[model samples]
Target: MHDLLRDSPSSSPRGSPYGPGDWAELEEVARAGNFDVLRSVTYNRVWITGQSYCRNRASIDSCERHLQSLWYVYYQCARHVSHESFEQDRWVLDIIRTRGRGPLTRPAPGGGIDIARTPEGTVWNDLPFLATDMTEYWINSCAEMDSKQRINAASFLAKLASTRIANDRLCQIALDLFRDTFESERPLGSSNEADDENEDRHRTIHGLTIASLLPSACAWIREAGHNIILLSDASWNDCSHSTIGTGGFTFVQSELGQRAPGGFSPWRWLYWLKRLHQIAEEASKADEKLLAEQAANAIDIMLSDVKERNSQILRVFEGAGDAVTQDKDFMGLKRKW
Candidate 1:
């Protein structure tokens, strides 16, 4: 499964090739991923507390949107981490690269396929629900660009937010089970554990995960100001107390860390994350190709050794059958009890 998920064009190191065996592994990864989604949505309980969503508008329609974002966003975020490429996924990579370029149809320079402004089967329409702090992000990154271009980028991002992209099937299935599992509406488990415990645990884990995504992104925000943006949902779930903007299924920390100086523009913070992902997209360029090839070779060697050893063990077992025929439990047949 890891192999299949890691084999995406953006994830694969540039110029590093995969053979038949590698492709076979990718197939297995896809198969396993599908099953994982099925099991996760099917068996998992409502992930977020309704009280959290209700504080704003417990009304039926708003609650439904919250539920949609919870399951859909969480699944997408998890994929970004588990599948590597910082879990940005393929469609996002395209948008980041060609965002303001308009509906691109020309081939990418290195034979990479061009991603249209609004690709079919994408989450382009769902951008508004993404809830990332992009208003500030636009200003920081496009400070020099004209307003029209900034608007274009913003539109692109909004589209990206709304589309389910890779999450269509999972969302469809999870939606079917929503009413039964929403934390507020969900039936109590065998043990009626308090919701406080669940919320606390999620908060702690989420904070750590978002914090960890930063160091990698610092590499890309070189020209951007010293603003701290909590990208995507990093600041989600925690946004109840903060004044922030979220869109395109991403989050940026609008407020400063406890010890840090005051917060900067939201756009400034998020620009860093976007830049960081762009850098990652190019990580597999020529410089890393040699290492990737070596890794591939090493895997083949290990597999070959394992195959030979298994055959040798089978041979030993098969030959042992004849020796068994000449012996008894503890002695030759003549001396057996």
Candidate 2:
């Protein structure tokens, strides 16, 4: 392990300092349910790679492959690792909690505020990269797992989503993976019957797993948005109209536009509604009755909320005329709300 951690290059034909045999040994340890090994590898990898140690493409590729191999091991050992232990691990929580720079305040001479120079933050600042990688890995793992194992994966996601640090970025990671998986099609190829059969099975499981996770992602959005609103004392109108922008509403608009083929549109709400219905149907098919019911209820609530907001917007436009409506950015407000 110490030799692998050294900066010197090894004689491996692949050009990575640590070759296939090293990773295979690590994978064996992971398969034995050794969480300590996982923790050590994660910490060392983040420390080395996240600090800009990968100066070239080969090094970067090696780092990425190392991370990917860790995820494959994680999937194999997930059932053996206790969920309670994983959830309560401070390192895991730190991975979630540490986002950007910590707040810094310094007083200037003569009792005036000065431009505070940013101090060097901790390695945890790069933790979001790990968090995102974990999310992608979890999504891919769902494609290979059985129903019960997939449920376990979802449970892990729920724990992450429930954290205060879980926000639109995490949700977007899952959404991006889902979009890719859903849009992927089999290549036109010669005969490979067994491989095609495996691909089909994986695709089916992937879709179902993603569908089950959407509601959790939605819940994270709502919770994060509510917190933002409370912190800023910003109304929905302020969200839409303010030039500075609110975090939550800005995320929604940005995501909506990204998903839209022609860019941002008023009808993006319909796209989201379709996703909610898809979640409900998929969950029902997976025999996740509670999840299906929750998704169905969320659909009803979102529809009611949109209807009420639209009516209110219409009434305001009627009484205040076109000028006021335009000035207030009522169209943007309607689209967001």
Candidate 3:
């Protein structure tokens, strides 16, 4: 999806450290979702990338704003879901109402011209990162989700944060927020009449959900072209408890962390999925000791799945010989989460 990045990121946003051409290319590619034909961008990665590009079009608050959006997408794939039960839901909606409502070009009423809106009736931004199609995709997809599914979505979101250990303040904030909002011991906030929806203990519910399932969610996103890297969440001792609190463990034979063969298997995801459900039930009990134990068990499951997936990835380049570089990045991640 980021083939543009495979080379360089052009036309990202005004005042961006990246060249205009590089960020622009990313915008076009994401908006098109391909190079050969036209298609709307689908997930949080592309959608938020575009949103940040336009919001900071003026270069005011550019660096911080742009970086923040990038980290959000790097951490979460989808925008706020339909179930905005927690304060996080309200924050997400505030963004969606403004940034997710229309294309980057859509004009404001009464000839109001802004970075995101103009008198010409809202033509695509210079970056064209945000589009109605992507917004619609989010809305339509989220609309079908019920409370149960949303709980699962919450868990998936946590895993996204856990996998990639971004060394940034925003990433830390997101991780902390996820942990706080999901902890079951924290009683649900009282309902506010002004709020859209009132659900008791929204964060606790989502937090519990987050503790269960990792490998399956990682597999699903990977197959969809979203690669979740493995990093030790506990690497930064500044943080609270270990990633074990999330019930996602990293236990596997690393030698297989190399490349993969041809045609990977989706069927293997079923095994991880079943295990995720089991862990989810355990997480719901809110027993710290039990969750930690399950996390250790989950490590075994994750290790097995990661080994096979990595093997499959490397297999694809088997016939390429020594044409590739010797860089660590070129070899991809040496460890699995």
Best by TM-score: 2
* Candidate 1 runs further than 4 Å off: 1-32, 35-88, 91-126, 132-262, 265-337
Q: Is candidate 2 or candidate 3 better by lDDT?
A: 2
lDDT of each: 0.27, 0.41, 0.32
**lDDT, candidate 1, 1-337, per-residue tens:** 3432332322312222334564344334333545344223312212222232223222233333323333342332322223223333443444333223233233455876443222222222332223332323322333222222222333233233334333222121111111111101111221112332221312321222211222211212211111111221122222311322222112223221221221222232222223333223332343444333332342233223323334332232234444433332211112123
Q: What shift in Å separates residue 156 of candidate 3 from its native position after superposition?
A: 5.2
Candidate 2 residue spans exceeding 4 A from truth? 1-16, 20-28, 44-91, 96-124, 128-132, 135-140, 148-168, 177-270, 273-291, 294-337
Better of 1 and 3 by TM-score: 3
* Prediction 1 global C-alpha lDDT: 0.27
lDDT, candidate 1, residue 262? Answer: 18
Ranking of predictions according to TM-score? 2, 3, 1
Better of 1 and 3 by lDDT: 3
Tens digit of lDDT per residue, candidate 3, span 1-337? 4433432233342333545564455444533424221112223333444555554343323433343333233212232222234533433333334433455432334676544433212322221222222222222332233333433344434433333322211123222322233222333222121221322333332332332323223323332222221212112222222341231111111112122211122212222233344444555555545444544454444445445556432332333345432322224213434
Q: In model 1, what is the error at residue 17, expressed in angstroms?
A: 45
lDDT of 2 by residue, 38-141 (tens): 66565554444433222322324344554444444444444234444643344435445434433222344477533212122223333223345555555555
